[model samples]
Target chain A: MIGSEEVERETNPHSIVSVENLVKSYGGREETVRAIDGVSLTVEAGSIVGLLGPNGAGKTTLIKSILGLITPTSGSISVGGVDVVENPNRAHAKMAAVLEGARSTYWRLTIRENLEFFGRLNGEVGTEERKRHRQFLERLNLTEKMDDVVNDLSRGEKQRVSLATAMARDIDVLFLDEPTLGLDVEGSFELQQTLTELAAQRGVTILVSSHDLGMIESVCDRGIVLDDGEIVADDAIENLLDVLQTRVYELIVEGGVAASTRNEIERAYDVVSWVEHRGCTKLTVAVSNANRIHGLTGALVRNGLQIRSIRMDDTDFEAVFASLVYDRPHVDESRAARGER
Target chain B: MIRGRRGRLSSSVSILRALVTRNILIMKRYPLNTAGAIIGLYALFLLVYLGGRSLLGPGFSGTLGALIVGFFLFIMGNASYKTLAGLFATEAKWGTLERLYLLPVKFSHVAVLLSISSLLVTFFIGFTMLALMLLTTGTSISLDLVSILPIVTFTLLSTIGLGLLFGGATIRYKNISSIFGLVKFVFVAFIVAGPTFEEVFALKFLPLVQGSYLLQRVMNEELRLWDLEPLELSVLVLVGLGYFTFGYVLFRYFTERARTAGVMGHY
Candidate 1:
């Protein structure tokens, strides 16, 4: 049993979405697979929540169940106040989503037409609502591609159009799964910026799942890390970083040491992971403890290694993710089950 | 706040409408199939007309008109089935169904929408064949708006129901593709060689033959429908209603199962 304070700490503001003891299985004949097992979480309203999991970690399954796209074997999910399993239509009314691709819209229809279709489907498409649709398109930087068919637009442009369609729905809850997948750097940054603004300005309860840890960190307020179909770490971004903290440092050498000397210095640190690029051995040393750096560098000095500069790398976010998912034999258990099936 | 039966109904309708519109747009992108269907239907009508002329000679005129109309209905029904199944199988193959499953709307709505959108393909063909037949043959098939309207409405409803049923089945069972194809083949074959089979079986429950019988009634202007056996019309209505109910139940079942199994996005 989870305490109320723990739940509150996990879900700041107000928990608008609650999922309890969710389980999902597939292909029940001679071989059945459990995709999700006993997953539970709370997502607060007006806060961007990141549901982070590796591929086949039941991330998509969990998201679909929350949206009432699937039923749970045993458990309950509610969007707003409506139970998703019992009252899917009511639950869906409060939410919208952008999956990997833009199937929510028509392929042949122009972007504006797609928006009109979805908006009208949501009863928001009217002569009076076209302006609002246009505003959303513009906000998503999709106005330029508004008249283009989805198949005609670039991947990023199509993604923008997809985002615009969900935005046109203007629902209270938004589910974004790998929203930045298959996007270029500029497009990814642009999308991240748009999401940040949308959540901050519109008070939309957004749930995002993505492999791009950086993007999730930048756009989300809190994140839930899932492994083996269970919530392992649920915390705010700052707290997650704090929990997963590891020592990473940027090291600069005055002059290039011999490969052998560099190897010895590398042996001195726990791990020397860097490359010699642009006339600099930009090494990242992983120290067991902060005090170990003195002896670590002393070994380098004794080995005639000139250390021109060294700076600590921010290890909060990366360390948090690593700690949550890395070296955990149980995480491998999930992978093994998936592979077997 | 909008918690009630009416709210859910409206939401279902809204989602269905969205899915249908999306499918219609997909059809628009590749109008080749729609155009091919219209042309193929007209050709099929021509063959049926010629077959009737040869089989029953001048005495076949009234029956030929009815046959033509019946052929159109069967084609419409068959076409509806093909369109729905193809949409599902192809979309699943192309990995689009996963994206659809991720949406908040029910999968049943998507199935219904697929059926609705598919109607455009058959309707276009059905109307085209009707126009062409009227222009060429002009064999009075009774232009009574009253009888034609009800029959058209019922026929469309029945076709949509079957289409939904087939689409729903395909969501879980991939073999449903072949099932739909086999269904279309059997119906088309039955229409071509219905008379001999009707005589041999003497079964009144068959839709294809009954459809032909209704068309025959329409062409002869015997207009004795209200006075005729009530059970016949009731059977058709019951069959259609049965199909619709079965489709709804199956669709809801598989949708719920898919959701829980996490196979909703397995496609």
Candidate 2:
């Protein structure tokens, strides 16, 4: 029998997945590696969350722990209200995942057979459930290749088959570890669109860990950034960019600036780089605040520099990702200001 | 949309069917490999029989019968002991371990289902080997259902337990092939010693040895289960239950350790 409090906690309704103070460490006596160190976050139901990190950043460890594929050294993970460590079968019933690599499917089994097998394994035995398997194949554009053996299919087709098999089951949460890795631009875009639609139409809460920043930005509603076994930032994509203070400005000056003026400009702004070409000096500056751009341009005008053009540069997701994962001064200051200790 | 949950028994049956079907489909794709393995096993058995006959005198008919029964028991036991670990290693290497673990069933159930499926294949191979041996050697073998069923069941149960133990070890420590090789040698020694010498009381306590001795009596000497001493029957049942229970507990313990260490999917 479950207590009322336990039942309520398990059926939180708002969050599809919740992890708190999770820590996983390996090794003993002499050396120790803390893979996931005190990371806590909640993924709301029906929202797509991007787990963004560089290599060895604990993204896979966190995902594995949350899914109950691995037990954490400490803390707790609850999926769809059930504690994963305490009730793995119940927790697993609510989730499905497409793991890394091409090993997710049996190479000898046909695409249709693989789907049918996985569907049955996940408790989708009814005829209606079988129909859902076919529907997933159709949606993934794998209907015609359903009878083809997995080994003969291209890498992209095999990945789509994997996705289709996972999606065939009626699960509340989906975990995808690098789903778009090694895919062509079109293939990546197709998967991104499919994921977006799946989340939108079926209300599936998707937690995807990927290095493709552009795909993550387009597909994920929120982003959780990890760095060296810690949660560096967890917020909406735009808010994450803001928290990292990633703002870029491009300025064109007509006159050749002397060393004194260049030094003054560097002192006034965080000059990322400056290049002179065809008698025009193009200076790219990064500022912590958007408001500082106007003041810096005014200061340059006051220095008797002819401003040919001044425009805000479009900051892509890559710059924000690099700032959050790598050691950047602006990111360090922003983290300090946020008091995320 | 998700449907209502099915009964536990029904869901388990479905999972078993799917897993078995998947393995069968993969096996079907490699027809030549399957045939080669069966032929190779038969050849090995033939070589062992011929070599042993040459070493022993031609008048050793009774000893040869016991040896044939011992070989059959050894093959069955070896298959039971290796199947779970072999299947687990394959799944881990294929990166399907985590996916399989995600099924809405207990991990123990998944292992049991997979082992059962593998046992079916082993049974086929064992039967083929038995037929080939009987035809080639022209030995008359008889099976007493009332006597042989319980003995065979207990023997397989004990062997399956050993398999589960090794399977759990594989989950914890990947690349245990060397350890398996050593274990196979130990099992072969037990099989050879169990039938060759009847003076050692301690030898009967080893896994499958006592069962092999009893099976040989039923198959070769036509001894019914009722004719066997009550003490011998009791010992056989107790050993089988004890080994199976111990192996089940050990496997569960190792599985938990592997899960906590996050190495369940690592090969």
lDDT of 1 by residue, B1-267 (tens): 334668657756776677666657766777886677677767877886888789889887756565666666676767766776567666666445754553455566666766766676567777677777877677656666566545554555555666666665666665556566677766666555544454554443444545455545654555744643576566556655665666677767765555554455445
Q: Show where candidate 2 strays beyond 4 Å.
A: A1-13, A29-32, A244-246, A299-304, A328-341, B1-6, B53-57, B60-62, B144-149, B196-198
Q: What is the C-alpha lDDT profile of model 2 across B90-160, one tens digit per residue?
A: 88887788898888787887887777777777776676677777788889877666687688778777878
Expressed as tens digits, the lDDT of each residue in A1-341 for candidate 1 is 21122543354347889888788777757897777877778887888998887677788888888887677778999889779889886677688777655454556789877777767666636666798787878887777877887878888888888788777766888888898888999999999998888878888889999888999889899988876677777878877776643577787876666878767776667665767876767778787578888887787788777888889976756567767775578667756876942
Q: Measured by TM-score, how close is model 2 to the native structure? A: 0.90
Candidate 2, residue A162: the lDDT equals: 81
Q: Give all TM-scores, in the order shown.
A: 0.83, 0.90
Q: After TM-score superposition, what is the CA distance of residue A250 in candidate 1 from its true location, in Å?
A: 6.7
Looking at model 2, residue B233 earns an lDDT score of 78
A53: Cα error in model 2, Å = 1.5
Top of the candidates by lDDT: 2
Q: What is the C-alpha lDDT of each candidate?
A: 0.70, 0.81
Q: Point out where model 1 deviates above 4 Å.
A: A1-13, A26-33, A249-285, A295-320, A332-341, B1-33, B48-63, B89-121, B155-158, B189-202, B222-227
lDDT of 2 by residue, A1-341 (tens): 11112222343559879988899999996998898988878889999999988788899999999888888999999998889989888888899888855558888899988988988887646789878877777788988998999999988888888888787788899999999988989889989989999999999999999999999999998988887688877778877666556577899998687888889989888999889999998999988888998888888888888899988877778877776666646547757887954
Worst 10 residues of 1 chain B by lDDT: B201-210
Deviation (Å) of B141 in candidate 2: 0.6
